[model samples]
Target chain A: MRELEERIKNDGQVLGEDVLKVDNFLNHQVDPQLMYHMGEEFHRLFQDKKITKILTVESSGIAPAVMAGLIFQVPVVFARKHKSLTLKNDLYTAKVYSFTKKVSNEISISKKFLSSDDHVLIIDDFLANGQAVQGLMEIIDAADATLEGVGIVIEKTFQKGRQLLDENGVEVQSLARIKAFENGQVVFVDEDQD
Target chain B: MRELEERIKNDGQVLGEDVLKVDNFLNHQVDPQLMYHMGEEFHRLFQDKKITKILTVESSGIAPAVMAGLIFQVPVVFARKHKSLTLKNDLYTAKVYSFTKKVSNEISISKKFLSSDDHVLIIDDFLANGQAVQGLMEIIDAADATLEGVGIVIEKTFQKGRQLLDENGVEVQSLARIKAFENGQVVFVDEDQD
Candidate 1:
């Protein structure tokens, strides 16, 4: 987590007020070494949760989820953002609004993938309004699967995402928690404060 | 490669004459163990290419690309299919026609990630018509970066993907090569015959 925070300070670009662009190393262009370390940390955090599958949404979240899946030795299932021709008809679907993109898209997972016997851990790159995670949780709930916990690479604590997940009784863990973006600079939550 | 071929034969679904769905293990619901092995095989094939970075498109390609990035000890850069709020304005863009989706999308990569000094290895889930890989090659060309080669998990020989890359003098390596799909059964190209 310290490494991630330091990397964010070194390379992360903050545009305007709410957008923290970590495309240099976190999302678009990824540091696989750092990704492996994040996976190890997540595995250490949730090793005892009996997680049978790791779930995430398409695009940015796939890197971390796949890395975590490798470390956890579990199957990784990603919900598609669009209804592709390859995707099956029988799916568990949910609608998610992206505050960053200012759009809502339907995310879905094949019904054959998730079942009541599976335990799911949702992973993602950034957690802002918590819409994406909530959508993923809905799929898990629809499948009657057990929600083990959520692992986030970077979280914006100033937003209501944490509170929303907390209200839903979903256990959440994030490597880097941003307190605020002061003057286009990141202010991380101090360890002692937590 | 043999292991990959076996897995495809066992789990892959032939939906018609064109679509061969391997989403069960390669895309939607992924087997991390198998993914790691595929990465290892790719590493073995491109070990001497001096690849400085691994490049691919978003969504399904991220899983194998990230896995190979881990083994190769390099950064992985994925082209964003859509222009998002997080993506920067300074980008190398290309238009690609998706044979699957029947739509043309602009894929872009931030100019900051790739450079002339970098040697890139492009990886993808499936190579049908090679449009996606061609789009990625355009980005690499725009940056004046060196493309070492392209690694594909599955290549449909019945299609013109291999011939397209070959005509461009681009080196390609595929784990499994499908000769044809007859009566919902996949027939792989005999390597010894080649």
Candidate 2:
């Protein structure tokens, strides 16, 4: 977590007050070594949860989710996103509203992949608006699967996402918690307070 | 490679003549251990190329590319796809036509990630039409980067993709090569012939 926090400070780009672009290492251009370490940390945090599957949204989430799946030795399912409103029958689907993009995208997972017997862990690159995580949770619920916990690579604490998860009593762990962005610099929440 | 071929024979679904749906393990629902092994095989194949970076298209290609990045101890850059025709100055972009979808999507990579000094190895989930690989190669050419080779998880030998790459004289290594789909059964090109 410390390494991730440091990497954010060193390489991450701050856009205005609320945006932190980690395209350099976390999203667009990925450092797989860092992803591996984050996966190890997630395993150490949720080793006893009996997680049967790892779920995430596609593209950015695949790197860390797959790495965590490797450590957890469980299958990783990435929900496919579609701009179209056309629906399918054999899939569990949910609508996620992205505040940045100002559009609602439909995310879906095949019904064959998840079931009531599975315990699922949700993983993603960033937890800002919590829309993506909430969507995955809905898919899991539709499958009658148990939600074990949520693992995040980077979290924006100043946003309402963490607060919403806390209100819902969902167990959440993030490798790096960004308190805020001030004058083109990142302010991290102290691990002691976290 | 043998294990990968076996997995395809066991789990891959042949939909119609050319479509091989591998969502059970390769794309939608990923087996990370299998991905790790695929990464190892890629490293074994391209170890002598002196690859400084790994490249792939987003969504489906992220898994194998990131895994190969981990094993190769290099960075992986996934080209972002856009449905719109918007262009940016700081990115190297290419237009890719998806025959199945009947749409032309634009893929772009940040200029900062690739350079003339970089030796790139392109990895992807499937190489059926080779449009995505050709797009990445175009981006690499735009950046003046040297493409060492390509690593494909599955290749369709009956498709024109293999012929195009062969004509271009690009070194390509595929873990599993499908010769044809006979009555919904996958027929792999013999390893000796490959």
Chain B superposition TM-score per model: 0.94, 0.96
- What's the distance in Å from true for residue A193, model 2? 8.1
Instruction: For residues A80-186, write the lDDT of model 1, one tens digit per residue.
Output: 99633445469999989988878888899889999999999999998899999999998998999999999999999989899999999999999999989989999
Question: Candidate 2 DockQ score?
Answer: 0.95
lDDT score at residue B180, model 1, on the 0-100 scale = 88
- In candidate 2, what are the lDDT values of residues B1-194, reduced to their tens digit? 88898898888888987899999998799999999999999999999889999999998899999999999999999999998555588999999999888999999999999999999999998888899999999999999999999999999888788889889989999998888888999888884464
Colliding pairs, model 1: none
lDDT of 2 by residue, A125-184 (tens): 999989999999899889999999999999999888999988989999999888888789
Fnat per model, in the order shown: 0.90, 0.97
Rate residue B72 of model 1 by lDDT: 99
How many clashes in each structure?
Answer: 0, 0
Best by lDDT: 2
Interface RMSD of each: 0.8, 0.5
Candidate 2 runs further than 4 Å off: A191-194, B191-194
What value of lDDT does candidate 1 attain over all alpha carbons? 0.91
For candidate 2, what is the lDDT? Answer: 0.93
lDDT per residue as tens, model 1, B56-113: 9988898899889999999999998873344547888988998888888889988989
**What are the runs in model 1 whose C-alpha is more than 4 Å off?**
A83-89, A191-194, B83-89, B191-194
